[model samples]
Target: MDEKLIQRLESAIARLESLSPGSKPPSGTLDAVSAASEPSIVAYDDLLVEYVVKVSLAAEKIGGQVHDITIVLSQAFATQKELLMKIKQTQKPDGGGMTEFLKPLNDKLAQANNMSEGKRSDFFNHLKAASESLSALIWIAYTGKGCGKQKLLLLTSYFPIFNINLASKQQLFALIFSGMSMPIGHVEECWQSAEFYNNKVLVEYKNKDPYHVEWAKALKELYVPGLRDYVKAHYPLGPLWSTTGAVVSAPKSAQPSAPNPPSASLANLASSSSSRPKQGQGMAAVFQEISSKPVTSGLRKVTDDMKTKNRKDRAGFVSSGENEVQKSAPKTAAKTGPPKLELVMGRKWVVENQIGVKDLLIDDCDPKQTVYIFGCKDSVLQIKGKVNNITVDKCTKMGVLFTDVVAAFETVNCSSIEVQCQGAAPTISIDNTAGCQLYLSRESLETSITTAKATEVNVMVPSSDPDADLAEHPLPQQYIHTYQDGNFVTNPVSHSGG
Candidate 1:
């Protein structure tokens, strides 16, 4: 046996001896005997130390992964800057034809997507989302016209990455201190870091970037609630430490004057160990499990209640008769269908949760107001007047037609979206989107288009000759980035004619 194990065994033996009834020790050895008798306390301390080490190792692994993600993000941004420079150069009067670039970026995005497929953890999913968002930002930067504020909005995507990283660290801390009985100084530091990140950094970011508040809200709607439930479920004993370096346990008056017998304490410890859930699992497994479950407390509860009520409501309609079911169908449809036009906060129009609506119109005058369309599927939205900004998010097979936008037209976390600008817009941004078709009018030709993590995007611009057919141009989705002479070089992928 190892020397430490032997020493522990000896100590345990002494503890058992000291705990015997009527036991007595030498005058100077009383305290030692008392300490030795509490072998379970020592065991608990050792277990905490083991967990601390495990947490450290887990932190290193997570840190490395986070670092890798940052590297990829930096590379993507660098490539975007290079592409912008190239576009600027090519647009110059004396600039020559652009060289054919390779598709290395496509390969990187493909790798990220493949890694995030079925049964992957949140870390991988975040990686995929980040990559896709980056691609969308790249597309917007390349194609959309924008000033500093737009660039800042593009940078806001990084907040999700920050949120996830901090959340992971917080979860690790929760795991280690779940059932701790004493106030640990190091653990206190961890708690303070979490509090600071939540109350200071995240709050400030959210306040500054009103356009991207969804990412911050996600931390509260998903991460925070899920973590609260997870701790409650897995560590029912709760945290026994407080921020003031005080142990949160029974008061001195309530605590027993004498500790439990050594035999009983050891028995209880063994039983608890055997009963612990996933006792043999590693820290990585724990983290993975935690990441996999994102319980949106309020949303989930509402959804569940809605489901139950719907089922109950339908039961009578279906069971009564076929005619009754037919009569109730329209009512159900009316209840679930999209709401009428509503201008929110006097500055924004909100259209959400509609499906297969072919004639959704926002015809009201709006030079100062913005528009947001969300969670709609197979829908068409027509905005008749110029708006300050427009964002289409988390929708599928959606089509948008607008007269003009004063600032930017953006699509995010969407798929198969079609946008038509009849007048003009300063910029069009696509991020974390796929299969977008942009129809640009003559007046909108000067509009800048930017995209990141997006694919299969095509732009149709009117030809100079009125009689000529509209020109179709496919945006580059892949690029090759290289370093030469102390500067990074990037080029879009090109295909030769067969």
Candidate 2:
């Protein structure tokens, strides 16, 4: 809504176009990169292969079962039926064309799977699990997750649900087992557990509705720390994995480019008439482009004016080797304006051997001390102490985490942000700002808990998601009373606030 934000976003859109507008298909395109026509002219960037390697290495850690993941991922490419069909048609007299293209991935996954059980350390297993999880997430991105878009519509044109759902076991297995994720049976079963669902619901309580809150909670639990963590760690910033799942469920395409013969204001009315077309166009562009570059539209909107006049953009982009020019912004910014941001509670971290909360109360409002929390949709709880690390077990009804150290209240940062999951419906919950910041290496959980009795305080009140899981915990009656009266106080700390 702010004019300044609009200008900044426009600048960002220009930048994206100049940097990576994506490979536009020839008007009735054919074999633009096929070797049959030109054997010696392989593009040979190895970028696509390199991306596959990163995804494979990350997933194979779990069990080296990637075939299932790939099969699910193939679903995302369903709309590219022409592309898929072409690859299939080009098969060398045998059924090994696409399969052969995926050979390296299969071998990598097999190697990850073949490691002796005893020899596979906990770290190794964690890495593998992370990779497999990422593969699934990537698959979801390809198909827009569950939302119907151009490719989804094209593929499921006759399906009643208006889209192909990956909730089924067979489809899930196909995606993961093919040197990608594990299997739908395994991943979905994880969602079916009562305890897992309860814990997941607790975390996702901040936003969303009740209808499928339980299912959504389970999905988030399976994704965060479990699958998303590995993918984020291994892939490049602008790699395909990040955007794959989010793009699948994208809104419909831009209404076939508005029929091309509209008057000025009529065109505006037509485009704004529905969100589906706009979202579809946006999602399509995002999915196609993420393969080569990072999506920073939500990260920051730096305008040409800002780059020239604003000191902050210059300081951040100039010194960091980023191209802070105005021509690289997202094209969607032209329509939607700058991203809207929401402040979130992020994980705790240590800096220079000092165990402290990222969003801590500053002595005098220092920007470095002013850490920005991304992705969280609800209020955050910041606990500080001499504590060396943190592990998020669960939250109380009051939405606070009690720890052994004297924790301090921290400042919060909010941004008007746009949520983009790269290519498909993000496999990861974009709501958990805590975990989201972890990807930046700027935040992490507080110290691990030991010799401490953790407890939660439940507050029975209207919440973001009314049907969210309710965990039982004993709370001090007096503390509850104080909080109700808006006079809550922090318990006395054993140590001074950091």
Candidate 3:
């Protein structure tokens, strides 16, 4: 086991123990205690109801903040025309300029002192951060600069909340349904703006500097996950009729009836019956009636209806005549093969599911095109010309030789992958990968390489002397990060060579 993981588990156990009852009572004594004195165990249905109510209330509060942030973003876009124009005119990717441009928007956000405090403060802060991310993304897509840190901030800050494995469903749903609902229009507009930038501005600089395309691509990636979450959270409500069901009634004889005088005149009997309590008129009967009906919600009804429809469809298909089933089976069984290497929209090259193929090549790639290699095993791919970016994903024992990448060369979720770059690549990123070997030619020696959750990464660079062997540098896999003076400072583990 990893030492860090062991420490984390130990810490979690300590916390749990601290929160547990101080000492366990004798086993028999617990059962002997009076049930009335013991704390009531909340039912799952009651807890779920409480949680839903709390989430709904929180959503409303957060929705207001989101609405305010949307207005701020819109105002910034409209009033800061001069700054935007300056951003367009600027040729360099200056992080400082981007910060300055965002100051006004941040100031407006800071003035929202009406926001409540405490744990809710964290939610408001996240809302502000998300707004800033969205605004920065739009600006980056518009100006085609500030692609480095701003894009990284957006990915790191907001993207993880959308991960189902990392966040609770309620949390994810609340954030998407509340924080993003109001700003969805703006998000769409930003997407359109990015597409326009990709088609118009980046196309002109296809040969000289196509790295600006990364901003557009990053914006698109950010938008897609949030959009997916939005769809999940905003599923249509079930019809009201679906929640309605026949109420179960008690038997007629079992119901309580009014008392009648046994030996009295007819008029006296009527008077006595009128004064007595009638059947099913008291609170107990009302309670009984309420308990007899099944509890359900519209959402649950819709989900159940959908499941029933699916089961019925399957049953109908299974019960079909043999000839009819055989005739329809061919259509269901026939499936297309996984996609091969192809260019999409004249901008992206998708290569997928090629196994044990050695001769894969993209000889005529332009600087505006991005290459995506996915699920290729024991394959060697060669790109003969410059491309905007390249991503190698989920591959094993794959070798990639590329001439140049104007933006970034990224490898994600792969093992035993080797990449060689003969020309310049501004950035090379390895993520969730293992056993990566990167060979950088003299012309590409200045490339910036970044890695996260990766191991066994070695970079080979040509030595100063032409006759000397290439110098191999292994990237540090372990690091220590400490909070100091407000920010975290990270340092790689020390070795004897240092």
- List, in order, the clash count of every candidate structure: 19, 77, 0
lDDT of each: 0.55, 0.30, 0.55
Better of 2 and 3 by lDDT: 3
- For 403-474, candidate 2 gives per-residue lDDT tens digits of 222211221121221211111111122211121121110021221111111122222222246576433222
Off by over 4 Å in 1: 1-340
Better of 1 and 2 by TM-score: 1
Error of 3 at 262 (Å): 52
User: Model 1, residue 389: displacement in angstroms?
Assistant: 0.7
lDDT of 1 by residue, 123-184 (tens): 33234434433333222222122222322322332223243433333443453445222212
lDDT (10s digit) by residue, model 3, range 142-219: 222223344333232323434422212343344333432223443554454334323322333345433433322332
